[model samples]
Target: MELFTVKSIGKVCVDKKGTRLKLDKEYIPALTNLEGFSYINILWWFDQCDHSDSRSKLIEKSPYKDSPEMLGTFATRSPERPNPIALTCANITYIEAENGVVGLAYMDAEHGTPILDIKPYTPSLDRVENPSMPQWCASWPKNVETSGDYDWSKVFNF
Candidate 1:
């Protein structure tokens, strides 16, 4: 197979201060007009889980309490994966295009995580009116808005 390459356009700034995306100087222009969207799909690297052992993990041993005991890597949103990449649809708190900074309401990424890319969250293309899932997770939140108030600790084992 031919080798492919991916580069970070920015980094996630997560701290006690807040969560934000700080784009590289060269990618600052790319943030133009991004403020128009209320939400954004962030593609980021799971840098902390990029080790060989994590990458080779193909099965997760019940990350969810009520789910099946063994779940294939693809079946669960576990960080251990071959690509070690993650996607999160986060609400935009604010955007500073000139300074290349985007404040976010929430992001499931660690501080200093490499940001692969950012795309406007268009419901027309990204949302599904009705999506099916396993019965195990049937009680999960139906949308991102509702997910904020969800009791995730009850759903997740870890």
Candidate 2:
């Protein structure tokens, strides 16, 4: 297998003020014209799960209620995986290109989480009008718009 070298371009910051992505000074120029996009797909590292044991995990006990008892790492969004990477789509609240900070409406990531990359969320390439899934999650929220109000506590096993 081929090996890869990855570096963090920025970090997520969540404070009493708000949540945002603070890009490195060198990466600030990449944010040019990014304000045109309404949403962005953020690629971040699961730093907390970057240990040898977490990276070696290929299977996990299901974390979703009513889901399969045991699931392969790829089947669920567990932070522990061969690569401790995560992707999240977030709405852009504001952007400070010169300052290299982005205001996000909401992101599931925690403060100080390393950001791997950021991509504009293009509907043409990302949306799926009809997605097939197991019956267990059929009752879950159907779209991102409604997901905010969804009672996720009921769906998570934890």
**Least lDDT summed over 10 consecutive residues: which range in candidate 1?**
59-68
Q: lDDT per residue, candidate 1, 1-158, as tens digits? A: 57779999999999897999999999999988786799999999999998999999998798797889999999977889998999999999998899999999999898999999999999999999999989999999999999999999999876
Which pairs of residues clash in candidate 1, taking residues 3 or more apart in a chain or in different chains? none
Q: Tens-digit lDDT track for model 2 on 32-124?
A: 999889899999999999999999999988888998899999888889999999999999999999999999989989899999999999999
Model 1 misplacement above 4 A: none
Query: In model 1, what lDDT does residue 84 have?
Result: 92
For residue 13, give model 1's deviation from the true position in Å. 0.6
